[model samples]
Target: MEIQLKLYGSSKILSEKETLDIQLPNNSDIKKLRDILTKIISEKYSRSDLENLPKTAAFFSEKDEVIDDSYKLSNKEYISIIPPIGGG
Candidate 1:
């Protein structure tokens, strides 16, 4: 299955791309997707950055609905990785 990922904030900086197209095996869950993303980011940046990824970012489905690592993804689903927002 193919999935589309939208990167935001720090994630965009780590990945060096606004969007990424990744191919996964059938029945891949969010955890698996996250691992793959981590690998990609780690290769481009530092391993420490990958460690902070899950803590600093939020995941969303194609509909912009927040999802957890256990969420199961369907074919062609779009995932968005957004970094934490701060405002005073």
Candidate 2:
């Protein structure tokens, strides 16, 4: 299955790109996607850089609804990874 990843805020900065398209096995879950993302980031940058990723970053579906790590991703689903917003 192919998933479209949309990066925002710090995720965009850290990933060095605004968007990415990744291929995974069928019935993959959010946790697997997260692991793949970590691997990709670690390969492009470093393990330490992966640590720099915001812990509060959220994963949303194409509908802009937040989904849990156990959620199974469908083929061609659009997933958005948005870092926590901060303001005073």
Give the candidate number with the greatest TM-score.
2
Per-residue lDDT over 1-88 for candidate 2, one digit per residue giving the tens place of the 0 to 100 score: 8998898876765545678788898999988887777777767765563464635567988888999889999999888986777878
The CA lDDT at 74 in model 2 is 92
Q: Mind sharing the TM-score for model 1?
A: 0.77
For candidate 1, write residues 1-88 as lDDT tens digits.
Answer: 9998897776666545678788888999888887777777767666575677866677888788889878988888888987787768
Poorly placed runs, candidate 2 (over 4 Å)? 14-17, 47-49, 52-55
RMSD of each: 2.2, 2.3
**Predicted structure 2, TM vs. truth:** 0.80
Candidate 1: the clashing residue pairs are none
